[model samples]
Structures are given as structure tokens and as C-alpha cells.
Target chain A: MLEAIILTVITAATPLLLAATGELVVEKSGVLNLGVEGMMVMGAVAGFAVTVSTGSPLLGIVGGAVAGVLTSLIFAFVTLTLVANQVASGLALTLFGLGLSGLMGESFVGQPGIKLQSLDIPGLTTLPFVGKILFGQDILVYLSFAAVFGVAWFLNRTRAGLILRAVGDNHASAHALGYSVIGVRYVAVMFGGAMAGLGGAYLSVAYTPLWVENMTAGRGWIALALVVFASWMPWRAAIGAYLFGAVTVLQFHAQALGIGFPSQFLAMLPYLATVIVLVAISGNRRATLFNTPSSLGKSFVPDR
Target chain B: MMRLELVKRAEKSRLMSVLSPVFAVALTVVFAGIVFAAQGHNPLSGIWYFFLEPVTSLWGVEQLITKATPLIIIALGLSVCYLSNNWNIGAEGQLTIGAIVGSIPPILFPDFVNPLVLPLMLLMAMAGGALFALIPAKLKTSFGTNEILTSLMLVYCSNLFLDWMVRGPWRSPQGYNFPITIDFHEWAVLNAVDVGGIYLNLSAPIALVLVVILAVVMRSTLKGFEIRVLGQSPRAGSFAGFSNRRMTAFAFALSGALAGLAGMMVVMSEIGKLQPVISPGYGFTAIIVAFLGRLNPVGILIAGLVIASSYLGGEAIQTSLQMSSKLATVIQGVLLFFVLAADTLILYKVRLVTGREGEGARA
Candidate 1:
């Protein structure tokens, strides 16, 4: 029972973790892409469609990442190149992604997806309670952990990460220092998009192993809120993702346990928790300023 | 070796401000053609069918009006929020709660028929939406939480709440296990100006009145001036004796109230009963409407109609050309994307310069 619950939590948390980790870097670089949901759905469709057609989940995951990058490029071009409002452009990206994916997934609507199978370690699978939880999980689950560690390490220790944070903290200052603000932002946004895509791919290929319209179903938005909920820290974000994943899976458990509360209300736990967490943490000015990017959702243009 | 750069203008270009959305519309039509052609349809005809034919017919025009009514009403309120720099993207949730709250009158008082039923429903709906709006507003004002994220997250909560209400408690005895409430009687339904299978309801005129009132408010009133100033510079507004915290709550409440009324209109004027899904994402779509109208109430009236017509256009092509109904959504997204991108042209001009030549000249 314990292992099973942990499995559900990890599976549920992986997508949120993957998406939020990418967005953390994007936010660290000081660009708020509200369209993570859109890019993610686009990735979901692209990954699913590719997997369905090519009969390879590996290629499908690749397809999902590439699709996310392409979708983010639109956001990058509008917000970075044309210097449009990030909030509005990001909203547009979400709206477009949902619609385009629906249109593209027309043929694949009812088809079954190729599930991304779990890893096979020779001795790990035969071990007792700890085996599956630690080592017998899918590649994506391990990737989620790698992403958290990699991002936390990159943000605090690396020079490139420092430059990314510097650019996010103050674009004008970063420009004065001769770092390519646009270039760094472009790369960051694209990376954010790719991660978001992988998150979506996992949703279709591994989580449900099916093609459904709006499959991401506001997970992207939850992931966005999770970033704020975590104060944009990678480790905290992973924990938040797991907590949220537990909340999401709780709906099914409530139905099974015959909890008196309506299942729909139970299903609303994650979103409500996000709002509550955001409201709760918002009072900490020090945390807000220290961890939150100052230039988030603000448009930056080089004056020189 | 020509390089392109965007130069900021001293003043926003008057002509570009007007032409910006037009350019966006034009760009959307062209890209829409590419999308349709990619889907194995004739590009030009698809454009005409998708963009033009919807507005060309009387039925189409009426359908456009029906869809635009709630959108205009909602966008009018969002215009207020946008002008005041308060982001309340959870209009969908407000709409849902409004529908649920508005249904209370006719749902409970099925046999209590009175002349005041519809008006009471409208009042309750607007109030419920405002109350829901206040959640995020209060959070922002009191705790300094981000309204955009909070309000949007609340939308999901409201949606689930509505789903639960309709499915668990409010589910009609005769609903046969379906997650829908009982249908509203005549007292609850908004009387329509029905002609040729088209509905011209009181919602349109009510929306029109709001447009006029808000347009004037934005143009002349001191409160309106405060909202504009607050949006442009919070520091300046603070110096001018305006409190942003109060304004934040006020803007959200005002917008939320309008969103509530819009939600009531959807139920009273169209659906006539509460269900699991009350809105077709009108709250989010209204954001696009607010922006396309440039956040002007009067402009929202026109912009809402165009977007509503595009919705009809999606349906039009779906039936006529067998295209997917999602086309309208795609076009709306494309339209918003371009509209935002075009907004840059108002404050900046694109110029081409030779990069190496400039370096050589400097040398």
C-alpha cells in the first residue's frame, strides 16, 4: 500500500516537476512565460501523434520537446523580438496551443498511445519495499530528479547560471555588463518550452497512455502557480509538485474511500491548495524579493 | 549587410494605434489560409469561408450577436481591470459562480412566479461573481499576493465547485444520473427578440448601455482618471493621493461584478439552467476581447462582435467545409498574438541599417 501510494505520487508529480523546473530557469532569467500550459499541450499532441505514427515512445518524447521549443519560439519572437507584453503574448500562446493541439489531434483523438515503459535494473526490481520507489521507476521519474538537482546546482554555482540570474534580476544591468540579454533569454525560454513539452509528453505517453483532448487540463497553469508557491526554488518546487500530485491523486482515493465530500471538490484540492499557498507565502517580503525575479512579466528592450 | 532594429518613438503613433489590430486581422486571415491549406482544404475559399462568410448571412449575423453579447459585457468589465492594471483572468470562475448563484432563484422558487424574478437573479449573479472576484482582490490587497495567479487558480476551484454542485446536490431528481440541474421556468429565462431563428435578447442593449457608461467614465470621470494614472505609474498615482491597494480591490470588484452580470446573462439569456459547464471559456476569451478593443469600453463593443463573428466563422466552416470547430479558437489566438505584436509598432518603428557598414564608417 505504501509503495503504491508513493508510485502514484511520483507519477503525478513528475510532469509538474518537469514543467516547473524549466519555468524556474525561465523565471530565473526574468521572463515569465504564462503559456507553459499551451506549449505543454502542443508538446502533448506532438509527442502523442509522433508516438502513435512512429511506434517509438523515445522518438515521441523527442517530438514533444521539439514541439514545445517551436511553440516557445512564437512567444520568444513576440515577447523578445517584437517586445510585446509578456503576459498578453503568453496568454495568446496558451490559447493558440490548446486550439492547435485540438485541431492537430483530430485523427488521433480516440487512439491508444504507446506507454513509456519503466526502467529495468537486474537486481533492483526483485528487492523489497524500497526497490521500485528508488530505482524501478521510469526514465522520466529519474529525469525529474536530475532536473531538480541540475537546476539547483546550475542556478547557485555555475557562471552561465549566474549570468541568467543576473539578466533576470536586472536586464539593463546585464546588458551593461555585455551579456547577450536577448540571447540568454531566448535560450532560457526555449529550454523552458522544451521542459514543458517533456512534461506534457509524459502526461500522454506515460501517465494516462492515451490521447485525450486538453489532457494537460490546466496542469501547466498549476505548474506555473507551483513556481510561485515554491518561491521559485528548484528543490522546493519538487516538493510542491509532489504535494500537489498527492492532492490530485487524493480525488480518486476519496471516491474509493467513500469520503463524504463530493469528488469534484476533492479534485479541486490542488488548485485550491495553490491559491492558499500563494496567499500564505505572499506576506514574506524578504522571500518574495530574494527568490522572485524582479523583472518577471516585464518587457525589456535594449536601449543601445 | 542590412540589420533591422526597433526604435522607440517619442509619442505613440496615432495611425499605427488604429491600424495595429487591422494589420493583425489581415495577418490572421493570411495565416489561417496556410493552416487550412495544410489541412488539405482550399486556402482562399477557407479564408473567405472562415473570415467572411460567417458575417455575410443573416443567421450568421444573429449567431454572431448571440455569442458577442456576454463577451462584450465581460470585456467591458475586463477593460476596467486592465485600465486599472489589475489582472483578473478568472472571469470564467466568476461566470460559473454567477450561473450557480443566479440559478438559485428559479431553481428553488420554481412555482413562485413574480415579475421581479429575472432582475433578482441578475442581482444575485453579479453579487456572487463580485464576491468570488473579491477573494483574489482581498488576497492581493491584504497579503500582497499576485492577483493574476490567485484569480486564475480560483477559476479551477470555481469550476470544480460548480461541477460538484450540479452533480452532487443540485442534480435534478429527473436528470437521470446526468450532472445537470432542473431547467429554469419562464420567470428565470431572459425573454428574447426572436426572429428567423435568431435571438436578440435584452443582454445586447444592456451591454450597449454599459459600453456607453464605461466609455464616458474612462474619458471624463476623476475616478476614471485615477484608474488610468494608477495603470501608467503606481508611484505617480500614489503621489497624486491615490491608494493602489484600495484601487486593486476596487478594480477587481468592479470587473468581477461585470463578469458576474455577464455570467448571469449567459444563463438567463441563453442556457436557462445551471450545468457542469456553464461557459465555453468566455472569461478567457474576453481577455482577448478587452485587448483587441484596446481596453476601451466602446472599442470592446466592436471588438467583441468581430471575435463573436469569428466564433460563428468556426462553426460556419465546420459545417460548410467540414473543418474542425477549433479553427475559431486558433484564429482568436493568432489574432491576439498579432495584435500584441503589432502594439509594438505604435511605440516603435522598425528600421534597417547595415551592421558592418556602420562599424566601417565609425572606424
Candidate 2:
């Protein structure tokens, strides 16, 4: 029972971790993409549609990433090129993605989805508790770990990562250094979109194995808060994602135990926890300021 | 030789600012026409139906106003927040709570029918929404938390809370297991007025009056000037002795009250009782309406009408053309994208400059 609970928590956390990790990079690069929900829904639809058409979950995931990248490119064009308000444009992107995905996925409703199978190890399969909790998880969970490692290394160790952080830290100063601020932002935003898409794909292809309109629900929004909850750190974001995942799964588990609370109140647990955690994280000024991207959400337009 | 370039203006153009929305609307028609064509429909007629069919008839126009009423009220409040640079994206949640809280009067006291009853219900709604909105505002002002995140997170909480209430505690005793409430008493309802050949409500006129009053106040009042000043430069606002903290609370409370009022109107006039949802994305859509109207009261009034038509038209097109109603959201999203992109024109101009095209032709 313990292992099963841990496994459910891990599954719940994977998508949030994936999406929040990508957004952490984007925020660190001085851009805030609020369309994670939109990109995610689009990714969900694209992955499901591709899987239904070709019977390959792998291609569906790739399709999901491509769809996300494309959607983010629209945002990048408006915000980065046209220098529109980032918040407004991001909101618009989300509304657009939700609508577009709904229209696209109308035909895919109730269709059985192709699930991404987990790795099957011979001896570990029969091992008491730890086997299924760690080894038996699907490919996406493993990819989430790899994403955290890669993003941590890229943001901290690489010269390129340092440059990206510098741009996010001070766009004006970075522009003065002759680094391509817009170029770097475009890349970062697309990466955020792709990861959000992959997260969405994970939802349809693995988590639920079905396509429902707005399948990502408010997970996209939660991922946005998680970036702040993690204080913009990659590894911390992983911990925060799992922590939230635990809260999400705990509510369902509690209900199963006949805790006597109405299920509706139980369903509200994740969102309430998000608000409380956001308040706590945001309460510390100096610490938040230290990790916050100085140029986060501010538009960057290079002088002609 | 020709290439496209954008040049920032020395000062924002008054003419461009006014024309930008018109230009955006025109651009949306053109784009939407292409979308219609892609969907295998006649582009021209589709555009016409998409934009105009909703308001062509008296009933349709009334429907437009019905849809626009809540949007205008909510956006009216949101304008204050946006102008003061406070991002309160949880108006949807605020509306839900307003409906939830306001329902208590009708549910618990279904027998109360007095002249003051309707007014009291609405007042409770304002209190509910304002109080809910203050959670984020208080956190933002006191703890330095990001209001945008806090507010949005609360939206999810409100959605679930409403779901819980209607599904459990507040469910109508005779609702037959459906997650809904008992029908509101006559005193708790906002009666619709039949003006000539159409059905209209008291909400429209009240919303219109509020918009006008707000417009005048925002233009002439000292507080309005303070809000604008604070929005443009918080430093100058501090120098002017207008506290940012106070402004934050004021802006949030004001908006929340308005959003709550909008919710009450929706419940009283439209739904007639508390249910799982009273406003269908009215809170979120009002954000778009607020921006589309340039965050001005009069502007919001006009933007509200335009957006309201889209909602009606989406339903019309869905049934007529056999397409998904989600097209309305697509239209809204596209219009907003263009509007945001076009709004930059108010501050800048696109110039077609000389390039190497002629040289390439000569070669």
C-alpha cells in the first residue's frame, strides 16, 4: 500500500515537474510564459490525436512538443517581436490554445488512447515494494528526472546557461554586452512550450490514457505557481512538484479512507494548498528577491 | 527596395490609439474569413454572420446586452486594478464566491420578500467578492507575495468551492441529485424589463450608469489622477504621498466589489439561483474586455458589447454551421492577440523603408 501510494504521488508529480522545470528556465531567462495551460491542452490533443492515428505514443509525444513550440512561437512573435504586453499576450495564447484544442479534439472524444508502456525489468518486477515504485514507472517519469538534471547542469554549469541567466538577470545590461537578448528569449520560451507540451502529452498518453477537453485542467496554472514556490530553482522545483503531487494524491487517498469530508472539499485541496504555499514563499522578500529573475515578465525590445 | 520596420514614436499618437482597435477588428475579420474558408465555408458570408448576425435582430441585440452586462461590470472593476499595475487574474473566482455567498439569502430565507431584499442580496455579493479579492490583495500588500499568482491560484480554489457547495451542502432538496440550488424568490431576482419588442433587464441600465459614472470619476477625480500616476510611476506616486500599499488595497477592494456586483446581477437576472456556475468565464473574459476597452469605463462599455456579440454569434454559428462552439473562444483569443499586437501601434509606427529588392531585381 505504501509503495502504491508513493507510485501514485510520483505519477501526479511528473507532469507538474516537467512543466514547472521548463517554465523555471524561461523565467530564469527573463520571460514569463503564462500560456502553459494553453500549450498543455494543445499538447494533450496533439499527442492523443497522433497516437490514435499512428498507434505510436512516442510520435504523439513528439507531435505534442512540436505543437507547443509552434504555439509559443506565436507568443514569442507577439511579445518578443511586436513587444506587446507579456501578460496580456500570454493570456491570449492560453485562450487560443484552449479553444483550438477543443475544436481539434472534438472528434477524438471517448476514443481509447494508446498508453506509453513502462519499462519491464525481469527480477525487479517481482520485488516487494520498491520495484514498481521506481523501476516499473513509465518512460516520462524517467525523462522528468533527466530534464531536471539537464536543466540544472545547463543553467548552472554551461557558459551558454550562464549567458542565458545573465540575459534574464538584466536585459538592458545584457543588450549592452552585445548578446542577442531577443534571440535567447525566443529559444527559452520555445523550450518552455515544448516542455509544457510534453507534460500535456504525458497526461493523455500515460496518466489517463484518454483525451478529454481541457484534460490538463488547472495543472498548467499550478505549474506556474510551482515556479514561484520553488523560488526559480530547478532542483527545488522538482521537490516542489513532488510535494504538490503528494498533496493532490493525498486528498483522493483521504477520501478513500472515508475521512467524512465532502469530496468536493477534498477536490479543492490542491488549489488551496497552492495559494497557501504561494503566500508563504512570497512572504520572504529578501530570499525571493535573491532568486527572482530581475527582468522576469518585462518586455525586451532591442534598439534598432 | 522595400522592407518592413517599426519605429517608436516620440510621443504616443492619440489618433493611432483610437484607431488601433478599429484596425484590429478589421484584421480579425480578414483572418477569421480565412479560417472560415479553411473550414470549407464561404469566407465573406461567414465573416458577416460571425460578426453581425448576433446583433441583427432585436432578440439577438438583447442577448448581446445580457452577455455584455456582467462583462462590463467586472471589467469596470478590473480597469482600476490594471491601471494601478495590480494584476488580479482571479475575477472568475471572485464571481463564483459572490454567487456562492449571495445564494445564502435566497436559500436560507426563501420567504423574505421585501423592497430591500434584492438590494441586500447584491450588497452581500459585493461584500463576498470584495472579501475574497482581499485575500490576494492583503497577501500582496502585507507579505510582498505576487498578487497575480495568488489571485489565479484562488480562482481554482473558488471553482472547487462552488462545486463542493452546490454538490453537497447547498444542493437543492428537491433538485433530484443534480448539483443545483432552489429557485430564487421573486424579491431576490432582477426582473427583466420589456422595452418595446425586446426583453431587457435592470442590470443593463445599472451597469451602463456605473460605467458612465466611473468614466467621469476616472477622468476628473483626484483619486483617478493618483491611480494613473501610480500606474505610470510608483516612485512619483510615493513622492506625491499616495501610498502604494493603500492603493493596492483600494484597487483590489474596488474591483472585487464590482466583480461581486456583477455576479449578483448574473445570478439574479440570468440563473435565478445559485448553481455550479453563474458566470461562464465571465471573470476571465472580462480581463480581455477590460484590455480591449483600453481599461477605460466608456471603453469597457463598448468593448463589452463587441465581446458579448461574439458569444452570441458563436452559439449561432455552432448550431447553424455545425461547428464546435469553442470557435467563440478561438475568435476571442485571436481578437485579443491582434488587439495586443495592434495596441503597440499606439506607441509606434510601421515604416516601409528602402531595401535591396531593387538591386536584386537589377542583378
Candidate 3:
């Protein structure tokens, strides 16, 4: 039972972790893409559709990432090229993604999905609890951890990472230094979209193994909140994701145990916890100011 | 290779300001045709059924007004929030709470048939919405929390709370296991007014009156000036002694109250009783309406009708063309994208230049 519970928690946390990690990079590069939810839903539908057509979960994952990139490209064009409001454009992307995905995935609804199989090794299969807990997860679970470490290293260790941070912290100064602020931001935004797409793909291909309208069910927003809760740190975001995942899983367990509270109220725990965590993290003005990218959410137009 | 570049205009284009929304609607129509064509349907008939057919008949027109009433009311309130730079994205949650609170008079006191019951319900709903909205406002003002996330999180909570209400505590005793409440008394309802062989819901005229009032307030009131000032430049507003904290609270509360009023109107006039669900994402749809209307009261009024027609048209396509009504949602999303993209043209001119020439200019 303990191992099973832990496994479920890992599964729940993987998507949030994946999505938040990508958003962390985007924010670090001084861009706020609010269309993670939209990109993710599009990924879910595209991934599912591709998987159904080809009978390969791997292709579905790739299809999801491509769909996410395509959707995010629209956001990149409007916000970067046209210099539109990031917040409004992000919102539009989400609304559009949800609607478009619903229309595209209409035929796929209720169709049995192809679940991504878990990793298995001859020696690892017979090992103890830690082996299964650590190595038994599907490919995405392992990739999620790798993504966090990869981002942390990329943002902190690489010379290119420094330029990305420079642009996010002060785009004008970065521009003066002759770095392509828009170029760096475009890459970051697309990366974020790809990660969000993978997260959504994980839902349909691994977690539930089905396509449903808005199956993301505010998870995208929660991933956004996770970024803030982590104070924009990659590792901290992993921790936050796991904590939320635990809360999500525990709520289901509580319902199974028939804890006197209504299931609906129990379901509210994750969202309510998000609110409390946001207040706690943002309560200290100095801390928030110190961590936030100086140019976050502000639109920049390069003047020639 | 060729590239597209934007050159900032010395002055904002007055002509484009008025023409952008029109351009956006046209762009959306073009996109709708593409979407229809992709779906193996005739683009022309789909566009006609989706946009034009609804308003061509009296019944369709009445449905449009009925749908527009809540959207206009909610969007008007949201205009105050957006104008003040407070991102209150959880109007849906506020509406849910508003409907729940507003239904108290009808659900709890089923025997109260007095006309006063309706007014009391309306007042309670506004208060409830205002108070619910103040949660994010208070958090922002006191703790410097991100109102966007907090407000949105509350939406999920409020929705779940409403679900629990009808299922657990407030489930109608005589509702035969349905997650609904008893039918409201006639005095508790907002009846449709028969005007010259055409029936209009009282909420329609109420919404129109609100448009005129808000237009005047936003145009002439000192409060309106303060909101605009704060949104444009917080530093300047602060120097002018307009407290950011106070403005945040005021904007949130006002919008909340209006959303609450809209929620009450929805339940009172349309649903006639509390159910597990009362809205079809009206709160979120109002965000698009607010933007499409250019954040102006009169603009929002017209935008509301346009969006409302889309809702009716979505159903029309669903029935006639055998396409999912979600096509409307797609249209709405595309419309908003065009709106934001076109709004950029108001301040900049798009230039198409060869790659080498663009590079030379950059250097």
C-alpha cells in the first residue's frame, strides 16, 4: 500500500514538475507565457490522436511536443513580433487551445488510449521497494527529473544561460550588449510550450490513459502557481510539485476511506492549498522582489 | 528572404483605434471559414449559420439578448478591474457564489412570495460577490499576493463548493435525487416583459441602463480618472496621492458586486432555481467581451451581443451541421487573438522588408 501510494504521488507530480520546470526557464528569460494550459491541452489531444492512429505512445509524445510548439509559435508571433499584451495573448492562447483541442479530439473521446509502458530491467524487477519506486516509473517520470536538473544546470552553469538571465533581468541593457533578447525569449517560450505539451501528453498517455475535454482541469494554472511558490527556483519547484501531488493523492485516499467530509470539499484542498501557499511565499515583499525577474510580464519592442 | 517588422508611430493612430475591432471581427470570420473548410463543411453555410443566421429571426435575436445580458453586466464590472490594472480572473467563482447566495431567499424561504424577496436576493448576491472578490483583494493589499493566481484558485474552490451544496446540504427534498433546488416562487423571479409583440427579459433593459450609467461614470467621474491614472502609471498615481491598496480593493469590490448582480440575474431570470451548474463559462467569456469592447462600457454592450450571438450560433451549428458546439469556443478564442494582434496596429505600422535591408537598418 505504501509503495502504491508513493507511485501514484510520483505519477501525479511528474506532469506538474515537467510543466513548472519549463515555465521556470521561460520566466528566467523574462517572459511569462500563460498559455501553458492551452499548449498542454492541445498536446493532450494531439498526442492522443497520434497515438490512436499509429498505436505508438512514443509517436504520441512527439506529436504532443510538436503540437505544443506549433501553438506556442502563435503566442510567440503575437507577443514577440506584434508586441501585443502578454497576459491577454496568453489568455487568448488558452481559450483557443481549449476550444480547438475539444473540436479536434471530439472523435477521440471515449476511445481506448494507448498507455505508455513502464520501464523494466531484469535485475531491477526483482529488487526491493526503492528499485521499483525509483526505476519503475514510465519514461516521462525519469525525464521529468532529468529536465529539472538539466534546466538548473543550463540556467546556472552555461554562458548562454547567463545571457538569457541578462535579457530577462534587463532587456534594454542586454540589447545594448548586442544579445538577441527576442531570439533568446523565443527559444525560452517554445521550450516552455514543449514541456507543457509533454505534461499534458503524460496525462492522456500515462496517468489516465484517456482524452477528456479540459482534462488538464486547472493543472496548468497549478503549475504556474508552483513556479511562484518555488520562488522561481528549479529544485524548489520540484519540491512544490511533489507536495501538491501528495495532497492530490491523499485526497483520493481520504475519499476511499470515507472520511466524513464530502468528496467535493476534499477535492478543494489542492486549490485552497495553492491560495495559502501563494500568500505565504509572496507575503515577504523583499523576498519576492529579490527573486522575480526584473522584466517579467512586460512587453518589449526592439527599436531599430 | 523577407521579414515582417513593426515601426513605432510617432503618434497613436486615431483611425486604427476605431477600426481595430472591426478588423479583428473580419479576421475571425476568415479564420472561421478556414476552420469550417478543414472540418469538411462548406465554409459559407457554416459562417452564415454561425454568425448571421442567429440574428435574422426574432427568436434567435431574443436568445442573443438573453445571453448578452449577463455577459454585458459581467464585462462592465470587469472593465473596472482591467482598467485599474488589477487582474481579477476569477469572476466565474464570484458568479457562482453570487448565485448561491442569491438563491437563499428562494430556496430557504420557499413560502416568501413577497416582491421584497427578489430585491433582497439581489442585494445579498451582490454583497456575497463583493465579499468573495475581496478575498483576493485583501490578500493582494495586505500580503502582496498575486491576485491573478489567488483569484483563479478561488474559482475552483467556489465551483466545488457549489457542487457540494446542491448534492449534500441544499439538495432539493422534492427534486427526485436531482442536484437542484425547488422551483422559485413567481415573486422571486425576474419575469420577461412583453414589449410590442416581442418578449424581453427584464435583465436586458437593466443591462442597458448599466451601460449608460457606467459610460458616464467612466467618462466623467473622479474615480474613473483615478483608475485610469493608476493603471497607466502607478508612480504618477502615487504622486497624485491615489493609494494603490485602496484602488485595488475598490476596483475588486465594485467588479465583484456587478458580477454578483449578473449571477443573480442569471439564476433569477433564466434558471429560476439553483442547480449544480448555472453558468456556461460566462465569467471567462466576459473577459473576451471586455477586450473586444475595447474596455469601454458602450463597446462592451455591443461586444456582448456579438459574443451572445456566437453562443446561440454554436448551438445552431451543433444541431444543423452535426458539428460540436465547441466551434464557438474556437471562434471566440480566435476573435480574442485577432483583437490583441490588431490592437498593436493602433500604435505601430507593420513593414515588410527584405532580410538584407532589415539587417542593414538594424545595424
List the candidates' TM-scores in order: 0.97, 0.96, 0.99
Q: What local lDDT does model 1 show for residue A287?
A: 80
Q: Best candidate per lDDT, number?
A: 3
Per-residue CA lDDT of candidate 2, range A200-250, in tens? 999999999899988898899899999998888888999999998999899
**Candidate 1 lDDT, A114-160, residue by residue in tens:** 99988957798778987888788888888899999999999999999
Q: What tens-digit string does per-residue lDDT give for candidate 3 at B225-302?
A: 999999999999999999999999998988888889999999988888888789999999999999999999999999
B1-363 per-residue lDDT for model 1 (tens digits)? 775568899999999999998898899888989988988999999988877888887777877888898999899888888888898899998888877887888888789788899899889988898889999999988898888888988898898998888887788999898888898888888887877667688888898899999989889999999999999999999999999988988888777888888888888777778887878889999999999999988778989998998888888798989988888898899999989999999999976768886456434
How well is each residue in A1-304 modelled by candidate 3, as lDDT tens digits?
8989888999999889989998999999888888989999998999899999999999999998889889999999899888899988988899899999999999899999999999865587657887788877788898998998999999899999899999999999999899988899999999999999999999999899899999998888999999999888999999999999999999999999999989998999999999999999987789889989999988888878
Stretches > 4 Å off in candidate 1: A125-127, B1-3, B194-199, B352-363
1 or 3: which has the higher lDDT?
3
**lDDT over C-alpha atoms for residue B177 of model 2:** 91
TM-score of 2: 0.96
Tally clashes: model 3.
0
For DockQ, candidate 1 versus 3, the one ahead is 3
TM-score (chain A) of candidate 2? 0.96
Predicted candidate 2 versus true structure: per-residue lDDT over B1-363, tens digit per residue: 464456789999999889989988889889889988999999877877778877889989889999999999999999999999999988998888887777788898878778788888888989999999999999998888878878987887888888888888788999999989899888888888889988887899989899988988899999999999998999999999999998999899888888888988998888887777777899999988998899989889999999898888788878778767788888888889989999989887875656665334334
lDDT of 3 at B239: 97
Prediction-by-prediction clash tally: 0, 0, 0
